[model samples]
Target: MSLKILITGAAGFIGSNLCEYFVSMGHDVLGLDNLSTGSLSNIEGLRLKDNFNFLKGDIRDIETCRKAVLNRDYVLHQAALGSVPRSINDPITSNDVNVGGFLNMLVACKDAGVKKMVYAASSSTYGDSKALPKVEERIGKPLSPYAITKYVNELYADVFYKTYGLNTIGLRYFNVFGRRQDPNGAYAAVIPLFTKQLMNKQSPTINGDGTYSRDFTYIDNVIQANEKAMLTVHPEAVNSIFNIAYGERTDLKMLVDLLKMSLSKYDKSILNIEVIYGPVREGDVPHSLASIDKAKRILNYQPQFNLRDGLDEAVDWYWSHL
Candidate 1:
């Protein structure tokens, strides 16, 4: 059956991808974006679809959030200020958007009686924990302001379920990257940023000798997690947090090598591009890997793309678009 869905950050890379996927599946998708970091170009394709509608609004405003949630069957809340560096530089603004805005969305969803909300939680919530293959049950203290905001999201979602009877699921995304991700922003994700630079034959900088690693999940895997979280009928899956990842770690050096090898298919010159070493970034974890057992057992999430496959697809998109 078709449903009415509201995607809070519909103009962003992940949110726009969600809008397109849901719209393609014949759902009535209402996209609300403040355009602070999200670009309209990302969702331009969806604008032409009859099943899609977009509202230019900020999540910080209660009225805007309420308006967006009203009559919506489900809410996929993806609006938040991302990037550790960005949050470190502007903690106040990040707090307002990530923490304040998220609270507003939860209230709106509860008051409007939305069936469920699947929000974009961050892996940064595992901060300072030296554990490998992070499990859903254990988490360490957050290292950055951005991490704190995302951790708070989980707390709020849990309380909403326990107190107000709102059904909510949180997916802790690990280093998500793929097509439509912005490679030009100052705080751009590593994959897209490195891919763009390598394609242009420029030396991309790798912080701290490039030994730091990440789970590096693909965008499709994230989309799959969101869909499963939103539509699943499994009683055990609702109102809990799950790690959405490919369950494998790749170091920065290996990541650059893979990107070069992938892009070299289009232009062999990229293989020879060198990387510059720099100081380690603040708030960066040494390594990150996830135990996707909870998500798989509950949500039936089966990621189709691994690191190499995802990189190839992402490289192709960036080569054509950038």
Candidate 2:
């Protein structure tokens, strides 16, 4: 049976990808985005599709959120104000959009009788724990305002499920990067930012002595987790948080070198560019690596793209488009 779905942040990098995939699968997809961080050009192609609908609105507005959820079978809640530094500088707006807006979506999803809400949680929730291969059941105190908000999201999801019988699956995303990820922002993700810098023959700066590592998951893996979370009938999967990652770690120095290698295929001059090291920014974890055993056992998630392969593909896209 064809399902009706609502994807928040549908104009964003991950959200637009989700919209395209689901719509192509013959599902009716309604996309809601305020276009703050998301660009309309990301989904302008889908706007012409018959089964795809777009709503220019904000999730902070309960009325708009309620309207978007009407008749939708599932809600992919990806709308949020991301970035640790931004959250640190302006915690109030981040809370308003991430926490308050998240509540509105939960209420709308609950009121509309939506089946499941698969949301984008963050690996930042792992916080300050020194544990290698961070697990779902074990977590430490939040290290930043952004981390606190994401942790709160998981808590809220649990409460909603227990109290009102709402079904939700939280995918704690690690350093996700792929096509459509914006490289032009004060808070741009590492991969895209570095890719753009190399493209421009500019040196990409490394924060700290370049030892900080992250799981650095590809976007496709994240989409797979969302699909599994939405359609899985497994009784144990609902109302749980799963780490969505490639189950590997690459440090900043290695990441830049690998990125340089990929970009060199297009412009060999990029290989000669230097890397500048700077002081570490606040609210950043020293290292992050996910233990994907829980997601593998429950969601049956097998990430196809490791960092090198995913970076090659992403570099190809950037070369052709950028």
lDDT of each: 0.94, 0.94
Instruction: Please state the error at residue 67 of candidate 2 in Å.
Output: 0.4
Candidate 1 TM-score to native: 0.99
Question: Ten-residue segment with the worst summed lDDT in candidate 2?
Answer: 313-322
In candidate 2, position 305 carries an lDDT of 97
Local accuracy of candidate 2 as per-residue lDDT tens digits, 202-274: 9999999999999999888888989988999888999999999999999999999999999988888899999
Quote the positional error of residue 12 for candidate 2 in Å: 0.8
Model 1: which residue pairs collide?
none
How far does residue 164 in candidate 2 sit from its true spot (Å)? Answer: 0.3
In candidate 2, how many clashes are counted?
Answer: 0
Q: Show the lowest summed lDDT stretch of 10 residues, model 1.
A: 193-202
